[model samples]
Target: MKAKPLRRLFIGFLLMAVVSTLSVATPAHCGKCNIHLLTGSEYFYALRDAIDGAKHSIFLAIYLFKTDNHPTNRATGILNALLKAAKRGVETTVIMERSDDPESFINVENEKTGRRLLRAGARVYWDRPDRKLHIKAVVIDHHLIFLGSHNLTHSAMKYNQEMSLMLNDDRIASEIINKISRFPKTPFKRQP
Candidate 1:
């Protein structure tokens, strides 16, 4: 009788191990795949295209967005695109770094951009932290995600060596959106 119970327990354990292994191997949304790897100019073009094609929503989390009065600055163009998207009923959100006074040039520019976006019916957020928000990504319509080292700056798009991945999969987009949703909101105070 004891032997019979031991045999049953061993079988149960083996079945549990197999189930665990299969669960680990098979993730949700297995159809999602890496469609394109963009680099240099192609990366920027892909980003621009994704931004322009956004239909439902646009979420941008960048480290910097230069708004200085320079003829070659591309921040203006990016901001304009976001504004246009907002105007067209596409919900837009820009999460940028927040700077202090005396060094508040970027902050000032971002404030103006935020006002414009709000007027155009878009939400804006400034990350207040000692360490910068070093993520650069744009999630559109919750169906595609363009993410990598490209920032919303002129140099990143035109001169700097950059790389990005254009993932045309709903699974990947959902994962990115979930991660972004977990980020802390404003008035972030570090806890000891």
Candidate 2:
């Protein structure tokens, strides 16, 4: 009788251990989605590839997209990719931060980059001055989402310790896209 009770106790302990291990190993979310944590320059490469591979549509709402279009610029590739995507018939739409002060660094750079994108057939919008749209997000093909701290700037992409998540969840992507679409489109003049 003693042996039987000891065996049961040992099995119970083993079961609890296994359960704990499995729980730790499993993803916290219940959704069947693939999540990749992108850190530092990894985000740039991933985003470049994602943009390059975009087929139907690409929606980008960014806080800062500063670029000089220089050959050696790290962020130039991403800018080129967006322009290329638009040229290739992909519907690319960009919503950038519009500062209250037009001559602000963010405003100037975003306008410059936005003009380039606009000329390439991409629809560009500036957020209202009163409301700041500091979203750093990209949705590709209504299926893939890149959301986090990584901005389309050289420092953030190449140097800053930025972190972002690439989620391959259609439901979440759809929700994000809807939200992005609803962002107030305030018109602003593009500098020549």
Candidate 3:
């Protein structure tokens, strides 16, 4: 009788240890998160690839949507990918930040980028001025989400050591999509 009781206690302790070890191995809810780290040009490649491969829609929100276009430049490759994605019937929507002083370089360059996107059939919106819209994210088809510190600028593309996290989870993606849908839109001017 004593041996039987001791064996049961040992087994119970072992089970609890195993359970605790597994649970504490990583942060909570990490099983479903599937986050992948993206750094530097890897960010650009994955973003461009996702836009290129998108079947239904692409949603982009950025602090600065500035890029230089040249045939030999990889930055232009990203811009062209967005345009081509829209041309292929992908419902592409972009939300960018706008300041009250439109003459600011950040605002001016962003507007120029917006017009190019507009001409290519991408719907562009400036966030409401009550708050600064600085979120940088891209959601594709309600399945993939990319969020990071990167601004779509020449420096970000060429020099800065930027970081982004790519998540592929439908539940999280749906939540993000629903939240983004509520952002108030501001007027965008078309360039002549």
Candidate 4:
């Protein structure tokens, strides 16, 4: 009688313990959120390869993009690659920050790049005038997403110490895409 009750109690405790252990052993959400960190020339190459490999779509939001066609300009290279991708029927969109002062050189360069991208068949938009969108990210086919401090600039890729994380998680990618779509668009900020 008492022994039977005690045995039942022990069995229940064992079951609970097993369940707890299993839960603990299981990988937590975001635990396997495959993330890679790249730097220097490797970083640029990784981004280029990712862009070149994109088949469905590419979404890019950056703070700056160079206008001139300098041979050694990193931004120009990335821009040209993106344009090529767009021309190849890959859906591409670029969102840039709105210039605070209308006459700033940085603003001019950004405007020129936006126009060029639009001409290449990529949709372009500017961030809200009140708030600048400083996010640097690239999402390909909603499967791979790269987010970091690397701007579309030569120094960022060649000399600056920048950190970028590439994640292949679909859940995370969808979350980021939703967040990006929620950003407010500014009106007539550029030719695009």
Top candidate when judged by lDDT against the true structure? 2
Per-residue C-alpha lDDT of model 2 across residues 1-192, encoded as one tens digit per residue:
899999999999999999999999954552888899999889989999999999999989998998985786767889999999999999998999987887889899899888889899998899987888889999999888999998898889888988999988887888888888887886545843
| Candidate 3 regions with alpha-carbon error over 4 angstroms | 1-33, 190-192
| TM, every model | 0.71, 0.82, 0.79, 0.79
How would you order the candidates by TM-score, starting with the best? 2, 4, 3, 1
- Model 4 lDDT tens row, 42-97: 66788888888889899888887764778778778788889999999999988888
What digit string (tens of lDDT, one per residue) describes model 3 on residues 1-192? 899999999999999999999889933543566788988888888888988999999988888877775665565677789999999999998888887776877688788888888889999988775678888888999889998888887567567988889988777777677787698877577422
Error of 4 at 45 (Å): 0.8
For candidate 4, give the lDDT of residue 91: 98
Q: Rank the candidates by lDDT, best first.
A: 2, 4, 3, 1
2 against 3, candidate with superior TM-score: 2
TM value for model 3:
0.79
Task: Report the C-alpha lDDT of model 1 over 1-192, residue by residue, as the tens digit.
Answer: 899999999999999999999999966573745668877677666666677888899887777776545755676677777778888989887777665442466666556666666777777776765546788888888877778888777777788988888877777777777886667657322222
Clash tally for model 2: 0
Off by over 4 Å in 4: 1-28, 187-192
Best by TM-score: 2
**Which residue pairs in candidate 3 have backbone atoms (N, alpha carbon, C) closer than 3 angstroms, thus clashing?**
none
